[model samples]
Target: MTQLTPSPAGTEGARDAGDPLAEGRSRAGWWHARWVVPSALAVGYALSVLFRLSLVTDQDHPTVSPDEQMYLVMARFLAGRPTTEIPGDQIIPSGYSLLISPALRLTQEPVHAYHLIMGINALVSCLMLPLAYWALRRLNVSRPVSYAVGVAAATLPTVLFYTQYAMADTPLPVLVLLWLIGVHGLFSEGSGRRRVWFGLLAGLAAGYCLLTHDRGGVIIALTAVVLLAALAFNWAPRVASALALASLGVMFVVKKLMTAWLMARIDGARPSEVGNAVFDTLANTQLMRRTVMRCVGHLWYFMTSTWGLGALALVVCVYVVFSKRFGLADRVVAFLMVALLAGITLAAAAGLPADGRIDTITYARYLSPLAPVYILVAMAALYRVRGWKKIAALGTAASAVTLVLLAVLLRLAGAELVKSYFVVWGLPDATFLSSLWPANGDWGGFHAGRTTVIALLVLAVVLLLRLLAGNRRAALATGVAGLSLAVFAGVASAAITERITEPRTKGTQGIAAGFIEAAGIRPGDRMVMDDGLVWEIRATMTFMVLDGRVWSRALNKNAPVPAEADVAVFALADQQAPATDSWRNAPAGWHVDRDVREHQFVVWRRR
Candidate 1:
């Protein structure tokens, strides 16, 4: 049903059809070589992701608490249970929780239910693999390159580790990638009717993107700008853009309809949650100004996280934008990625409340959905390289390495001994980026963990230069860069899992989960969380003793406790706790069942 897209996309893609890697396409048996190869590759990638996530996702407890706790609470609420969080704090979207809700029904134990959600995470997140492979194909990226990038993208710790958490990020990469594909088809397809279909498809993905994560708003905004570009340039059919946008409008209508029914069942949730702080970002010039340093910090750290492929990717994107040699479609996609990188980085940089820690430098988690671009960027740079463009890419990459080395030097010079601050903000454990400190100092004589990255980046640039030399040079350079990145990513991700991600649930938090249960809390108990307890304690209490009927007293200490709640879970450090600053202990008229002073926790029952 598909016809050749307009040239030079068609012209360039036709050249790729003769690629030795795609030789099988000539033999179109019943299996249909075009679909068969990509399908097999997709299935293989999906299974690998599922298997990889399975090994580490079955944790005793959540590592990224509060965020995980919030998700769990949201899931239970979606699964026809009572609200678990304080009112006004539930600005979080329920899109990911909708997926997690089904798993809660499979087991009574909170941990088991969490594990089932992890399995669900693996399943839903792996959909990105197939979608990614298909997206690359739609973009007319060569078959071998598409499949290779698809598999390579899965190897990133960002792609794997987040699945262990119940955060919306688990499914974002796929959703974002799929939306981009729809945008491409909506604009570049030969048939006007097919274009409208693609537009509708894109819009649906865009709607889901909004639901899945707050960053989805940024994605939607980026799409709006891109669609406008399509209109101005006459790149897309007017009907297609209208249809794509209309689908997202329908999504809003659906959300509004669902909100009223949901509000009745789950308390404390906002009428509808869409974008958070997005308006403040645009209106406040100071907020935008403050984001500059943070934005650069986020980008620098992300480059480090990607092992320096981000630099090459940036160069490739810039080159694509200016180079008319690339077809309209290729350039537009390139522009989209580049824009997304900037938009996400800037948005992430904003609203990092003035904190003393240098957390931004280690924060790479924000733009991780763009992980696939690392290898793909270098590969694009390799594709159809000219003398001037190759020079420019190499020069830019070299400059990036210099900047990286300089940043490390500056860090060493102005370093603080805030070892405690290295604990990550979201996933505070060793599983996250902040925990990867340059130990023994950045100037540890001949050895520093940071130097290893710099060296690799320098080598990658050198290899790219070599790659541009000739066919013989290209073979050696390509093989070394490709194989090295692949092996490094695999080993690094595995080591991270073994040394870090695995330990999070088994550490203090896991012990705490058990402690909470042993301290007189039981599975499926209706619990009330005292407002005076700290966030960490609250997260653990909510997580360990879930019955879907958990309610927060919120900020009102005088607020009446839920009449049906069986237990009041309080922390020793709470304001109302005994021996607190006010010398207060226990809520009035409550009976203390267990005063576990050693653990700084207590369980109480209503009189």
Candidate 2:
């Protein structure tokens, strides 16, 4: 059956034939608010992907966060290792790695393999834009707002940044969005067969999401709750509702069990009692407040960057509830939006700890998985507001003035919101706002943070005034401007971030590469790293040159070097030279090497 799309507000199921803009396809031409909008969005997304691809070529290896490095290693394992060599227990899920392993199999070169994995990630992330657009359209959002939603998903800095990195941050959002799309289909389709198929698809998508990241556990739980609510309200027939609920619940459980089995197999053993004890200890309540605070900070940070989309969503929800203009579909979207935000917030708060200090960088990464939802709901709210043209122009003008004034005032005061927030919370001030701080400090470090706060404040005030005054046009304008500023801020911030961090990441890669080259290590050569080198370096080494066998052995500096080793790298406390005691009586033709990071590499040759 052909998908039925509701006509836009004025079209009444058909376009004005005399209007030249309506001169495409049949009565439901994609250019007629359904297809054209998503197509345009796809074009924009493609451009962004191209831009990201251009940046990727600048470095020998793609930039990787620590988590990304882990995924890359897992991908490598999946790509090459024999089934028997796979371990029995995995701390990290392999779904994402497994998804990208095909790229690795196609290429033997580490850099090429890394590019392939990131290319796949970028493609998936780009596809999310259209997925979001389709989902919004299915939920009956207006054409303009759906386009905005798609654009936001495509261009948002966090979305774009992670897409270029080899991590599940990009994939999870797409998966969750797919699940939501399936859920929407399950409810909206009338045919029993179609409903059943949609239900199955929804269940599969949710399960796949769960397998990709533990965060999907929250999505799974939310699915059951939503299904229960639907059943309670008689939203669907008993048989259909029961089937979907059961299918989703069963899929979630099956995925969990399957993942556990796969992880155990890959890790070589299940987690031991000691590991569980440490996990329990680390999960103590004393850390909850900090984690919650950090997550809250991240949410606020995301909202600010997105032109206060979260704030706009709140106002829209309240208005929808009171105005009684919302149809069932709209109401459902609103409810699902709230549930997802709450679920992710609580999950972030509970699932991670601040680790004794504010790690401004890492916690924000968790929020990227929800970026598409945030963009969708925010845009959906805007679409609900009518007569936005004049108000949008006015709001944009007002926003420009507000931004200038705020920047001037902030520059004079020299205040940094990040420091203030930390001081209030009594946490060690980390100085940098993980996702908010302009990466290059190009915008005057902390000045950018201040400007962001002011921008959010302006957008919020304008939106509230428009809403309270019952000026729907102005409210619409404010929403549009807010979204516009959101894209601008996010894109600019990401570019600065890349510029600032690229060199450092490249430097790290260079150091690892230098060590590998100097060691004269060849394919299959055993290269042991000192235990103190940290996983970051170890992982980088593993990715930089995939051929060499790498391991970290907790050997003392004085211990005899393994005669089987071709090379050994040691992480020193400082710029200390390698002590000869470890290899004093080494076999003939042994020598040591150094890298800029104060690491010592020794290469051993046989006579």
- TM-score computed on alpha carbons, candidate 1: 0.82
Q: For candidate 1, what is the total of clashing residue pairs? A: 2
lDDT string, candidate 1, 166-246, tens digits? 788888877777777777777674788878887887788777877766677777777777777777777888878777777
User: Candidates' lDDT values, in order?
Assistant: 0.60, 0.56
Candidate that would win on lDDT? 1
In terms of lDDT, the poorest run of 10 residues in model 1 is: 440-449
List the candidates' TM-scores in order.
Answer: 0.82, 0.75
On residues 1-607, what C-alpha lDDT tens digit does candidate 2 reach at each position?
Answer: 0112322333434543222333334656655655666468768778757766765654445445446666666677778742221211244655788889898789767767777776787677777667876776664554444555576666666566656567777688788778876676666636767666766677677777766776776677777776787789877565666788888777767666755655554424342232243356347788554444544555554454445555555445544434555454445545665666666655655555334323342144566666567656655544444444533543454455335434543443223244432221111111223234445333223334554555456465545544543433432443364456446645553554455446545666644555566555576666666656555556566566576455555555445555566666655454455445434444456555434333443443443
Q: How accurate is candidate 2 locally (lDDT)?
A: 0.56
